[model samples]
Target: METTRRAGAEIALTEMPDDGARGDVDAATQIAAYRIVQEALSNAVRHAPRAPITVSVIADAADVTIRVRNAQATAVAGVPGGHGLRGMTERAHLLGGSLEAGADPDGGWTVTARLPRHPAPEASEGTL
Candidate 1:
């Protein structure tokens, strides 16, 4: 949040679990979740400078879901196409999770990731 704010974008925490309320999510899952949001926020700021961004993290008994949505770009400065989205998706898939990113129908872009709270043991063993 501070990172985006520092980048001159208006950001908001639309939803989040209480501290320590994430339940029994593993360390790998936790780390993946953080990285997913990190990349999402970076993409938003880079592709839609000055746009309003809303971030939401909802943790349930089964999985932790993250959504980062930004309003239409006020100024797009990057050349586009980077490893950010791919890295984010790989992280999720490694943890038996999934990620999707695309432009919203109305306008703007949104990235969503769903990471299992208790992933299968073999899923992270490079079989993916």
Candidate 2:
């Protein structure tokens, strides 16, 4: 969130750990979540710099859910096309998780990823 702010974006962030257990998530799971957020933030800054962004991350016993939403762009920056979404989807699936990205009804974009707290052996072994 701080990184996005430094990039000149106003973000509203919400982070919560279920049962008040902040350390419930494994290192690998944590890393995947971070990367998803990182890419989402970067995309928001690039595609909609002046739009308000809201990020929510909720971690529970079974999984971590991350949602990054950016309002409609206030200015036309440039064309948008990239492999960021693909990479994010692959990372989540590799961790026995899932990701969804698309335009919101309000003319914005949203990226949501849910990664298991404990991935299967094979899934975790795969390169992200």
Judge candidate 2 against the unseen true structure and give its global Cα lDDT, from 0 to 1.
Answer: 0.89
- Candidate 1 lDDT score relative to the true structure: 0.82
TM match of model 1 to true structure = 0.86
Q: 21-110, model 2: which lDDT tens digit per residue?
A: 778777778889999999999888888878999999988878899999999876455656799999999999999899999998878999
Clashes of each: 0, 0
**Candidate with maximal TM-score:** 2
Where does candidate 2 stray beyond 4 Å? 74-77
Would you list the C-alpha lDDT of every candidate in the order shown? 0.82, 0.89
After the best TM-score superposition of candidate 2, give how far the Cα of residue 4 lies from its true spot, in angstroms.
Answer: 1.9
TM-score versus the correct structure, for each prediction: 0.86, 0.92
Considering every candidate listed, which one attains the maximal lDDT? 2
